[model samples]
Target: MHRSDSRGVFDALVVGRGAIGATAALGLSRCGLRVAVVAPAQPAPSPLDGPGTWDSRVFAMSPASRALLERLRVWDALDAARVAPVYDMRVYPSGREGAPELHFGAYEACVEALAWIVEGSNLSAALGRALSFAGVEDIDARVEAVDCTAPDHAALTLAGGHVLRSRLVVGADGARSPLRTMLGIAATERDYPQQAVVANFETGLPHRDCAWQWFGEHGILALLPLPGERASMVWSAPQELAGELLGHTPEALAERVAQASWHVLGGLRVLTAAQSFPLRLIRVDRTIATRAVLVGDAAHVVHPLSGQGMNLGFGDVAALLDVVARREPFRDLGDALLLRRYERARREAVAAMRLTTDGLQRLFGDHTGLPLPGLLQPLVGARELGWRFVAGSSWLKRRLMAHAVS
Candidate 1:
């Protein structure tokens, strides 16, 4: 462990170094604040490890998120060849009987592109590089304890017995945040009783820069187009069904997935072994307490079906930075009043997203026979509604997009 004297205390201490934490630290540091980020050492061989290892997980970065990365000067650092533009999105119900299709295109909204499909590791590495260049000190240590004794200052103790003080403490740690737990904040959690099986695969046909989602009896399956002849997939299903998929050999799994997807990609070849993560809805009672605040998964965890998880975290960083940059004279950075501004601004946004995602999960995950017909008509209508929604709400969408980059 390394130690440094607290001559001039840092302006902020950000715990967690995932995409959200790193982005928050970089944002604060770029705004002329002295920021220190604490995280464990980088994973061995990196997280992205195989031909299947080329970041099986990918994010559908809304236009707003793209602009935010651009503002942070990090978007340019990502290899253009690796980034795939999502010019259109196609969502439909699965099966021969009740399936209805909905299409959304950037041309309909008069934008360059609706979103970008990016590998998780590529985005993280780009953000890390930006953080390094912005002079944000990355302390290679785990935080053992955090003490918010004083009103204007919060203190942190690392595993190696190093103590560091800062005006504000931001917990972007993740859903099971140590910092949040240390503050005695408990989360309200509900497991969806489903698992998301993610993988990367090569398709016989080119994706043509379109992302697709098929809502089926099992659950929702999303195929996001990637650079080259590849696509990333998130298949959420019941635990038993997920286990069955997991039990298959790679070649066998590829054949099953190809058939399940109705051969949309023609012959499918699995490039990576299937990986699964249990699905859940996690929301903390309070995101702010005294001198500390929470951001990203540390604040909330939404369903990944909509691909809004990371984007929501980016919203947190953007809002917090705005509040901090506009603090009144003589106001402490960690002052309760100053921190409340962030709380109020983010609470409604987070709540709305939680409700929206939860509602979708519940509506789509129900396999009961009663709501089938009623659900089918609306599912058909949703395709038309989605197109109108995206086209008619340009102003609201622009505001949201702007927040991602701001």
Candidate 2:
């Protein structure tokens, strides 16, 4: 529903063209909104030709995320040979002997796969192609200011002083969103004392489509399945340990990784150089204000331990599309009450995920080296008990798996 001419305003203007923002622009366009995406153009990634060239950054895409991409026609466009399905996941607790281990299987869940391990470059390439095919307008500029005071439409002033008007402005910027600041939104932030070190490897033994995770005193280490006899590792290690890891030679790092993972996939050889990113939790008081809305990391960022950060951002795009599509006929896309409806729909899910990821990080992160006295002993025991309880209960596992897939 576009307003009458002369003003040349778009129905929706999306800022940032990362996966989430790009996907939002496509979704908004499909919803029949005259949409445009504003961001500097990026060079397309070079083709992923071999094991040595695999991108170190990969995401564990949930079933919900898969379906959204499928619906948008971006799924089939991906390089199937590069995508890895996670049929099984084995989670091991701290190095205590006989520590309870949890397992999840696709068969138990009655699904094709628990999740799909996709390289960032692969997904981004597909999105870029889809955007081109869909012919969505692209505004290659950085936003300098936003004017949301207008009742009918919001105006975005670019870096060079050009202005673009849109009924609704969607923020898909990263965790440190400049648009969020321009909109005067406050975010509560907490930094984790660790960094996620990522790299890809060729396993000595076939991964058998299984993902492995170990929660040890050092940190959480996840080895997600990759095509062929390969795997991608996300090791959330303490800051000091991460620095040491980064300092090691590729061969030495591979040796360390093999030993830490108990050689579960046998020996490992480096396929990609190691890279590290700091971890943090970012939460906003609200996702909408006036004619504006936030999506992806701009709205929330959770610990990577659960591997649901990207999925949550996809969930935001899905919910926003649904709400705007079903709005009352007379209501504008940026109507205050209409935007609030989208916020209410996503509030609970976002909070629950933040609590779960943050809570687990705290629960397993203690390395105080102090003796637990009296009453504090049971609290220490709860970690083991919790894992055992979840592993032993089929119903609980199903519930947890069901939530994850959705």
Candidate 3:
């Protein structure tokens, strides 16, 4: 690597240019920080045969996340047609006969919409476009080494033998982030032993902008509305089950999904082949290390059943930007005090979501046995009460909705 002695110069260096990384870079740059983004070369787009080898994941943008994207000037570039607004959400607990299903809608809260479902590709592209327009330096190289021995500056070595220095390094890389490792930050990871099978299809009936979730015996399945008569499905199940699903022909798989989801979308036709990803709960011991901070999956990853993974990362971006924006002129951006402020702002929310999603996944995924007599009634009643808790409180719902838009 070409070593450089340049010190105390760069405002920040962001590693990874995926959705979270790109958004963080854009946020920092917009706050007047000279930022450098190091990202892997963009992979080729997927063919019509199946879900792309490159991540074809879609994200449900909460209101707060959307606002943050707008502030970064990234959301406007997205094609409106490709974006689907979720006006309502239906959640069902499997095998619960006579139990009232829970429903949430934007109208109930007097909001224009609850959230927007957008493809990961579109959001990434939009962020890239915004970054280019903002004149942020893009270093299309992978990081080989990182040194944060010095408090005022952290040094990075790229694969191409170029050394770059920055006041702060942000790890917005995905779960297995190289930057996180380079900084020696420990992560607690729990494999859910389940894989999420995702795909897109055309439904016989239009989704009407409603998102549905079914807590099935095997696992949770979510059908997120897409534009037109299309919708995206995420089926979380055991690895063996996922393999069985993957073994089926595209048409057969579509049929299986229809059955699993109780044919919620009517007759389903696969527009894309199914692809599976192993589900896991990962949380870094801390989001901040000396001279660096972690964002996105690098910081934490929860069950996708709630669709809060990316939104959590966006929360980090927002908080970090706010922290930096308020820093005094002479204070180092990577100073412990500044980093602690960012950490404090994020810990409570991240911890709450992690515990909440993890608890729900375990509770519903249990196939042990059903209760009897009085116990069963209370159990059913409690489920209904939980829904009431969610539906009754606009504060909680609005807080969640706000996260999606940011």
Q: Which candidate is the best by lDDT?
A: 2
In candidate 2, list every pair of residues with a backbone clash: none
Candidate 2 wrongly placed segments (more than 4 Å)? 1-7, 366-382, 393-396
Query: Which residue runs does candidate 3 get wrong by more than 4 Å?
Result: 5-8, 46-56, 366-406
Preferred candidate (lDDT higher): 1 or 2:
2
Positional deviation of residue 352's Cα in model 2 after best superposition, in angstroms: 1.0
Model 2 RMSD, rounded to 1 decimal? 3.7
Against the hidden reference, what TM-scores do the models get? 0.88, 0.94, 0.89
Tens-digit lDDT track for model 1 on 214-314? 76677888888888889888998878889988998888888887777778888888886789988888989899986899999999998888788898888
Identify the leading candidate in terms of TM-score: 2
lDDT against true structure, model 2: 0.87
| Rank ordering of all candidates by TM-score, starting from the highest | 2, 3, 1
Tell how far residue 296 is off in model 1, in angstroms.
Answer: 0.3
Over 18-61, each residue of candidate 2 has an lDDT whose tens digit, in order, gives 99999999999988889889987778777788646898889999
lDDT (C-alpha, whole model) for all candidates: 0.79, 0.87, 0.80
> Which sections of candidate 1 miss by over 4 Å?
1-8, 44-53, 96-98, 368-406
lDDT of 1 at 305: 81
